[model samples]
Target: MDTHITGRTAADIADSVRSLLERGVLEPGDALPPVRTLADRLGVNRNTAVAAYRQLTQAGIAVSRGRAGTRIVDRAPVPQEGFAAGSVLRDVGTGNPDAALIPDPSRALADVVGRPVLYGEPVIDRELEQWALEWLGADLAPRDIRVTVTSGAVDAVERLLAQALTRDDAVALENPCFLSAIHTVRLGGYRAVPVPVDEQGMTPAGLRAALDDGVRAVVCTPRAQNPTGASLTAERAAELRAVLADHPYVLVIEDDHFSMLSHAPAQSLIGAHHRRWALVRSVSKFLGPDMCLAVTATDPYTADRLAMRLSPGTTWVSHLLQRLAFSLITDPEVREGITRAGAHYAERNDSFAARLRAYGLPCTPGDGLNVWLALPAPARAVAEQLMRRGWLPRTGEEFAVDGLPGSAHLRLTVHELDDTDAERLAADIAEAVRAVSRSGSGMIDR
Candidate 1:
């Protein structure tokens, strides 16, 4: 079948490609014609064909591989954190907090429903704003800051990037980045400049290289960085800030997703003198994912821009939800529960890491819901062996940025596992590694 893409103008050409995709004539991985070939065939200028390809790329309907040519994006759904649907295997890869650890919102719901919020009223609930101000101000003091309520950390990041960046603008992202962050960047049609992350968080040199490459914005995870669970140390934070001291205008967004649930103290990359920045703290980790409320603290200018997108009467966050979150977070009993939850995650993750280490795997219990287990063989090979043993784990390659080499690690969420299961998993992981080694299939660099 001759898959036809027929049009003269750029918009028309792009629309034709979309039509072909819709009709199943142009499948994913199918390459569009070279600009010159398409132009000659359609009797249009070469630039017109280029522009059409660019439009498709920006819409995420296609991807450009330079000399290799542009091809359709798969459009398959990206894997998200949480349970895998209908899986019979024991899932140790679900990046979810223990449901029992989340604070009960039943008691707080009654106190939060005092009054109905109407249009033209302040978007943020007054009580929530006050509480959020104090909470964020403690970390980002002396600098003028304003609070904006977003649906969640992902929403805040998307909005923040939209407000500060235009399509095709470059943004710095961690090498083994969070899934949502990667999706957000790609969907926004922005270029993601990879910054390598080490044990102490994003390396200063990597940040410098990204800044040198002209990234307009940088998204950082201050604590409990997803996937690897790496947190920035005080010294490393200072070094990163120093590197950014020169380029103070680049918008810096810190997504502190595991805020109340993180055992590590927050180490900020946003310096006092920085011109534009945002610190986003979501309540989902401690209050439950369904809460869907995140408090973003940012410079006045950034706050103003974000507010425009979240303007009252149209896109504002629900005042009732904000009030409920504030009520639960400030309650004494809820506070204790959050603290205990943090401890429980830390203890369980540590115990699992110790067991993996005893089995000869170089696993570390980072300050998050998962353990990053370094494998001597390929992570996929080990994961395959694990699956054969009725276990499912997330491979580190899934979190790695595009253009980077495949990873030799696995991110396992073992915090919910009891001692018996934990031990079994450890033993299974050891057996998996040994099986891979004996097969002599996937030996690669660490």
Candidate 2:
């Protein structure tokens, strides 16, 4: 059946499709008529229909499959990491740091109290700003960098993108991108150009292709990339820097979200000669998610634009939150706790991967809070079986982009699991993989 969208302009046509989607008339995977066909039916220029489809694609509501027509998006390109609602199964997909591992902010609360921050004051806490400048500056190549504070990594990313790009501007993102970055690019009406990532982080060939495609900005996770836990090697970082040198004006944003907690050293993307770049670090993984604080160090031009939105008395992050994070990060005891927590996460994930390998499912333990387990069967099938066995696992499909095939990998978090729990879960996962292999397509209910 042909999808009927009654409108001429791009906005009108996009709105019609959006309404049909909301009403469930345009179901996921349902194909739209060819652009030319739609233009003829609507008695408008073919370019108008094309423009409308482009809008839908940018908004992450529809996808163009080249020879195949455009279709409504089945679900978000990247799903959030956490327990699914109404699920009673033990969750191994929530990308959460162990609560016990997070340093208690209450102990730091007393230290955070001081003079109340008045109106028109500097947006960032002075002490925090100075600390961040020193911390971020030490790693960056010689450059005139300025610092800006935002609510968290997500906030920093959103502000950076807004400052650097406009509607439909192409931005290169890692293929298995972070969910928030996917959401930010989609909601901002910007085009996301996917660059493939591997064990060594963003590949040189993929990044070169994206640069050739005229992407205005690039968002990279330098270490402990979400879902995949890939980190850039020194060699790969050099290659990427070389490729980016020709495109000096392109804004490169590195999200070092796992900084203190990451076992990997920072392999930076911003070379000394690159014209525009930002490095954002957040305390969410170490201090606590509730801390809601991140510091962004960037080139002066980007900082000026970011400051427009972060001006005092308007969108500035609360100094109280900033102080709390600063205190937690600086306390010697809290620092030790964070260091131990980091080691604990790495060890737990490594142990889980080793167990899975011994069970005949070879997997790698990456630096992030989770382990990516590769199964012999499709991850969704294995995940469904795991759910039946009272474990909820997140399939890699949620993190893939660009019409890429669903991965046989599962992103699992085991930082909070005990020895017994880890062993049991590994055994169940192996069984689930075997079951899926035996049953094939019949095992999973659509």
Identify the candidate with maximal TM-score. 1
Candidate 2, residues 1-446, lDDT tens digits: the string is 34468897989999999998888888887888899999999999999999999998877788777898888876545566556778788988899889888776777778778898787677788898899999999989988989999889999999899888877789999988887888888777677999999999999899999999999999999999988999998999999999999999999999999999888988898999998999999988888788888899999989999998666435788888888888878889988888898899899999998999889887887889889776667788888889899998888877875546657778898889999999999999999888877887643332
lDDT of 1 at 349: 90
The superposed Cα distance between candidate 1 and the true structure at residue 290, in angstroms, equals 0.8
Cα lDDT tens digits for candidate 1, 1-446: 12388887999999999999999999987888888888888899999999999999878788887898888876656667888899999999989989999877888888888767786788888888998899998987478889999899999999999999877789999988898999898778788998999899999999999999999999999898888889999999999999999998999999999988888888899998999999999988888889998999999999999988776434788888888888888889999999999999999999998898888887777898888888888888999999999999999888876734457889999888999999999999999989989999968756
**Candidate 2: segments with Cα more than 4 A from true spot:** 1-78, 312-314, 403-405, 440-446
TM-score of every model versus the real structure: 0.94, 0.87
- Candidate 1 C-alpha error for residue 355, in Å: 1.4
**Alpha-carbon lDDT, every model:** 0.88, 0.86
Give candidate 1 misplaced runs (Cα > 4 Å).
1-3, 57-60, 312-314, 403-405
Superposed on all Cα atoms, model 2 deviates from the true structure by an RMSD in Å of 4.0
Q: Show pairs that collide, candidate 2.
A: none
Error of 2 at 177 (Å): 2.0
